[model samples]
Target: MAVITHDSAVRRQLRSGLICAVVSATSFGLSGPLARGLMNAGWSSASVVAVRVLVAAAVLVPIAAAQLRGDWNLLRRNASLITAYGLVAVSGTQLAYFNAVAHMEVGVALLIEYTAPIAVVGWLWLRHSQRPTVTTVVGAALGITGLILVIDLRSGLTTSWVGIAWALAAMIGAAAYFVLSAHGDGSLPGTVLAAGGLLTGGLVLLAAGAIGIVPLHATTNPVVFQDFTIAWWPPVLVLGTVTAALAYVSGIAATRLLGSRLASFTALLEVLAALTFAWTLLGEAPRPIQLLGGALILIGVIVVRRGELATPDAPDRA
Candidate 1:
C-alpha cells in the first residue's frame, strides 16, 4: 500500500509539473504579441524588458518573502546563483535576443535561440560526462528540424554575423537558465529565486538604460491590437504579471520537477504557442508547413519525455 501511494504521488507530481510547464510556455508565448503592441506604441525593447522585470519583481517579492518566513540567510548564501540567474538567464537572454532581432528577422533570431536545448544537451555531455541516450539525440534532431520548419528560415538568410553571434549568446543564456534552475537542492524556494532574479535583472536593465548602453524609449500611448486600441497599462500589466512573473516561477518549478534535459525540450512548445498567438491575436496566420512543424515538435517532446522517464536514475557517466 505504501509503495502504491508513493507511485501515485510521483505520478501526481509529474502531472502537475507537466501542467505548469505547459502554462509557462503558453504565457511566455504571449510576450511577443504583447510586446509588439507596446513597440507599436513607441516603447523600445529595453524599456519593455525593464518594466516587465521590475513589475514582475514587485509582484513576486512579497510572495517570496512570505514563503521565506524571514529566513534571509538562504538569499545571502545563494547570492551568486541568484545573480547569475538574473543577469544571464533573464537579462542577458532578453538583451541578446532583442539585439539579434534588431539585426535579423525575428524568426531567424528565435530559431537560433530555441536551439538552446541542443546546447544544454551538449553541455551536459561535455561538463557532466553524461552521454545522451540515442533517444535523446534523435528527439533533439527532430526538434531542431521542426523548429527550422516552423520558423521558415529560408527567407531570412540575410542575417549578419553580428546577429548570429547575439542569437548564439541568447541560446547560451537559455541553456544556463535550465541548468541553473535544475541544480537547486531545494534549499531555496523557487519563488524566492525567481523573485530575486527578477529584481536583480530589472536593476541591470535600468542601469544599462541609464548608462546609454541600450535605448530606453517609452511612451504612455495606448497599444493597438488588431482593430482596437487599448490602454497602454493593459499590455504592460499582462506582460509583467502573466508572462514574466508567472512564466518564470512556473518554469523554475517545472525544471525542478522534470530535470534540465526534459524541461528544456518541453519548452519548445513555446514556439508553437507563439505561432498560435500570432495567428489569433495579430492576424498573422500560420502556414500549413508550420502546423506540420508543430506536430513534429510535439512528437519530439514526447520522445524526450519517454527517454527521460526510462532512465530516471541514469547517472552522469555511463
Candidate 2:
C-alpha cells in the first residue's frame, strides 16, 4: 500500500511537471514574434528585453515578498544563487546571444544556445556521477538532429569566430539557468527565485543601457500585428506578465519537479512553439521539413523521459 501511494505521488508530480513545462515553453516561445515586431519598429533588442525584465520584476517582487512572509533568512541563504542566476541565466545570456546574432545567423546562434541541455547532461555526469543512460544519449542526439533540421542550418549563413565564442558563452549561461533552477533546497519557492533573478537582472540591464554597453532605444510609435496596429504597452505588458514572469516561474517549478535533464530536453518544444506563433502572428509558415523536425523533437523528449523513469535513482542533482 505504501509503495502504491508513493507511485501515485510520483505520477502526480510528473503530470504537474509536464503541464508546467509546457506552459513555460509556450510562454517563452510567444516572445519571438512580438519581440521581432518591436525590433522592426525601431526598438533595440536590449530595450525590449529590459522592459520585459523590469516589468516582470515589478509584478513578481511583491508576490515573492508575500511568499517569504517575513522570513528574511530564505533570502540571505540564497543570496549568491540569486545573483548568479540574474547575472548568468538572465541578462548575461541575452547579452551574449544578442552579440552572437550580430555576428552569425540567428538560427545558428539559437542552436548553439539550446545546446545548453547537452551541457547540463554532461554536468550531471561529471559533477554528480550520474552517467546518462544510453537511451538518454540517443534522445539527446535525436533532439539535436531535430533542432538542426528545424533551424534549417543546411542553408545557414557564415559564422565568424567571434560569433561562435559569444554563442558559446550564451550556451554556458543557458546551462546555468537549468542547473541553478534545479539545484535548490525546499526553502526557495519558484516565485522567489524568479522575482529575485528578474529584479537583479533588470537592474543590470538598465545599468548597461545607461552606459551604452547595450544600445537602448524605443519609440512610442504604435506597433503592428498581423492584422492591425496596437498601442505598444499592451504587447509589452503581455511580454512581461506572460512571457517573462509566468515563463520563468513555471520553468523553475518544472525544473524542481522534473530535474534539469528532463526539463531541459522538454524545453526543446519552445522552438516548435515559436514556429507555430510565427506562423500565426507573422504568417511565417513552417516548411514540411520543420514539421518533421518538430515531430522528432517530441519523440526525443518522450524517449528522454522514459530513460529517466527507467533509471529511477539517476541523480538529477546539479
Cα lDDT of model 1 by residue, 175-274, tens digit: 9999888766688899898999999999998898899878899999988887678999989999999999999999999988877788899999999989
Question: Which stretches of model 2 miss by more than 4 angstroms?
Answer: none
**Residue-by-residue lDDT tens digits, candidate 2, 237-286:** 99999999999999999999988998999999999999999998888999
Off by over 4 Å in 1: 1-9, 314-318
Reference-based lDDT, residue 214, model 1: 80
> Which pairs of residues have clashing backbones in candidate 2?
none
TM-score to true structure, per model: 0.94, 0.97
Top TM-score prediction, candidate number: 2
lDDT (C-alpha) at residue 47 in model 2: 96
Q: At residue 44, what lDDT does model 1 achieve?
A: 96
